[model samples]
Target chain A: MEYLIIIISAVFVNNVVLSQFLGICPFLGVSKKVSTAFGMSLALVLVMGLATLVTYLIQNYVLINTWFGEKMDITFMQTIVFILVIAALVQMVEIILKKINPTLYQALGIFLPLITTNCAVLGASILVVTKEFSAKGVESHMMNLGESVVYSMSLAIGFGIAIILFAGMREQLELSNVPKALKGTPIALITAGLLALAFMGFQGIV
Target chain B: MSKFKYLIDGIVKNNPTFVLVLGMCPTLATTTSAVNGMGMGLATMAVLLCSNMVISLLAPVIPNKVRIPCYIVVIAAFVTVVQLVMQAYTPGLYETLGIFIPLIVVNCIVLGRAEAFANKHSVLESALDGLGIGIGFTLALTCIGLVREVLGNLSAFENKFSSSDGMLVFVLAPGAFLVLGYLMVLFNKLKDRKKKA
Candidate 1:
């Protein structure tokens, strides 16, 4: 039940995109078409889950662990290493994707490059690092491997939902006659504001 | 004569946050109050200026193929320096800025100017452009911060501590998204009216 609450709360109340503003570049950039958006979301879900699992081990066993049975703290090196790992992972996926389905690769091309620098990608890894669970008012300052993967998957789901919704709205907006200046990002932003307001309703669920 | 336009462009006509919408992560995340915005802005400005200066100095020597990576290294170096100093002295502010601080290394505004303006321009020009754009970014963020703080918290620039309870949304995660989204709309409307008149 607790885990279910964690997942649900993350998806709606603490949405990674709408609420936390982690992945706006891709959120606003690739969200024009629902089909492409779904692909990106699926990619995100997988990456977030896998990346969190690996990064968590890296942090606890590598970055925080030292050779010769000693403990080392190179926490500051996180920024560089995380980006490097994420860049490599994204590239590997790109290569596999290109060989498997060139069209899918083309569809994901823009978003893949965009995700390399996405704060949300790094944000998920960092959140699990920083997240401290409080159970029954007692703070558990540590995250086990299971919890890390769970949180990352939950955050990715939240991102996917937000993107699909935004893409749907943008699709409809394409047909609706609108003002000239507010045709593109302006109207899209206003639409986001209303959606954000609706998302705010989820705050009460927790 | 044409040189003056460069200075004017960054402030109003091509304001980084509102008009161009270049770097929204730091703009929205760090601007819970005027104070946080100012601090983050200054930190970003310092890094931008140094990185621009370094890139301009290296522009003549750095090969075209390797320039982007070189610029990333330069920006990341300065960012690391900022990260270390902040972690040591201002741990609290460091925590408040959170991931947004490290994300600065990837901020399009910094790298954008470095690649577009800094590498092509002279050292002095690069520095000045950094100053102009940095100030523009700061002003835009401060505006958002002021509004978010005032409306969300009711206590302007009260990140430190005070007797009153602020609205808290301005500081919370969602508040950043909502604030920037609406502010963009309002800014667009104003620009539209100005163009009409």
Candidate 2:
């Protein structure tokens, strides 16, 4: 029940893209085509899940654990370490995918490198270690490793849903008559705002 | 070109938020209020300025194949410093800015300038470009924050001017997108007019 609540809350109520505002770059940049948006979403899910898992282990084991026979708290280096890890991880994943599965590699080729800087990947990983979440009746506490991975994947799904839907709308928007000044990004942003407002109605569901 | 031109260009022609549209995450997330927006902007500026100068200095030695990771390390180091100092001195703003303070490592504006301007330029020119872009970003964020605060909370810089409830939505997530969307339109129109003039 707790895991279910976590998934629901992440996907609907506190959406990563709509509410938290992470990864707006891809949300705006890649949403011009539904096919591309879907591809990006798949890449995000895979990377976000893996990144959170690795970052969580590093936080618990490497940062807070004993070092050189003396207890040391160097978690403040979390940002630097996690980014370097994520950067290296992305490269490794790309190389492995190229070797093992060229079909999937070709699909996600252009997006893998781009994911390095996609704040969503970094943001979700950071939130996993730092933030706490609570659904309506559940006790609020820091998520365990399993819960963190689940939450990260769900957040990525929420981002996927939002971007996919926005891309569909943008496809229609391309055919419509927008004001000359509000042609491209302006109109797209306003549409996103409306989508965000619509997502607000889901607040109390969890 | 003059040294000052680099700075001014960042503010006007290549405004990070308004014109270049880089670093959308912090621009949308942190601008719920004027003060929060300004704080985020200044923090980002400090990192951008430092990383730009360092990256420029190290550009010659960094091999082309590994430049991106090298730049990321330089950026991540400065971000760590900023994060630690903010946690020590201004805990309040630190809490409000939350993960974003650290997320500065991924902010495209910093890395963008490092690659686009710093890699090819001298340290001083890169620093000025960083400052220019930072100020432009700061001005844009503060403007968005100011508008949202006034409309959403009937306040500016945390001072509530009106007792009556404001739009409320403007202080929320959707308002950030809405405000930025319209602001982009306004900026576009103004730029067009300026071109004609």
Candidate 3:
């Protein structure tokens, strides 16, 4: 029940893209078509979920502990370290996928490389450490390893839903006649605004 | 001087937020109020300037294979410094901006300028580009922030115009999208006419 609540809230109430504004680049850049959006969404879930778990461990064990056995607060190194970790993780995933699932790798292709710079992945890793989550009027609590992993996956799921839906909207949008000034990104952003307005109705659900 | 053109380009022709459309995350996320938006922009500018200068200085020595990671590390270090300074002095803004500060490490504008301009330019030119682009980003954020704050909160530049007159949506996520979308349309229209002229 607790895990379910976390997933629900992360996916809808506090959507990483629509609400928090993380990962808007890919949200806008890759959502031109449903197929591409789906591919990017799958890549995000895998990378964000794994990156969260790995970053959580690194933060708790290595970043917080100095070599002198003193539990020092080196959290400052997080920005540098987590990004490097994410860069390396993307590479590893690419190599492993190529060795085993070349076809899937080909589909994911360019987006996999682009994930290195995706803010959503970096945002999830940082949020797992800094932000707290709660349910049912309970006191807000920082997530443990299990909770962070679940949170990351759900956040990615929310991202997936948003991009896919937006892609569908953009597809329909292509058929309609928009004002000349509002043709490309302008129309898309306004549509996303409406989507965000609709998503706002789900607030306080948890 | 050619250097003056570089500076002017960042502010107008290639404004990071309006023209290049880089660093949308911070632009959208932090512009709830004029002060917050300006704060975020200046913080980013600080990182951009320092990283651009340092990266240009090190371009000769950084191995090609590892240059991106090297730039990331340099940008991250300065961001950490900014984080500490803000936390110590401007605790309130620090609390508000929170994770967005560290997240600056990945802001495309900083890294993009480094890869595209700073990596190849001389130190003086790179530094000027950073300042120009940083100021451009700052101006754009402040403009959006000003619009959002006034329309959403009935406030202008931090002064409340009328507390009761504000619409809640402008201060929320949806408003950010609405305002930004309309602004983009306006900008695009202007650009089209300029091209024709």
lDDT of 1 by residue, A59-136 (tens): 887888777877779878777776667767877888888899898778666577667667788888877886675443
Q: Please report how far candidate 3 places residue A199 from its true position, in Å.
A: 0.4
Candidate 1: Cα lDDT at A158: 94
For residue B122, give model 3's deviation from the true position in Å. 0.4
A145 in model 2: Cα distance from truth in Å? 1.0
- Tell me how much of the true interface, by contacts, candidate 3 captures: 0.81
Regions more than 4 Å wrong, model 2: none
**lDDT values for all models:** 0.79, 0.95, 0.92
- Which residue pairs collide, candidate 2? none
Q: Which stretches of candidate 1 lie over 4 Å from their true place?
A: A1-3, A67-70, A100-107, A134-139, A177-182, A204-206, B1-5, B60-63, B159-178, B193-197
- Each candidate's DockQ: 0.44, 0.93, 0.84
- Docking class for model 3 is high
Better of 1 and 2 by TM-score: 2
Q: Which residue pairs in candidate 3 have backbone atoms (N, alpha carbon, C) closer than 3 angstroms, thus clashing? A: none
Every model: Cα RMSD to truth:
3.3, 0.9, 1.3
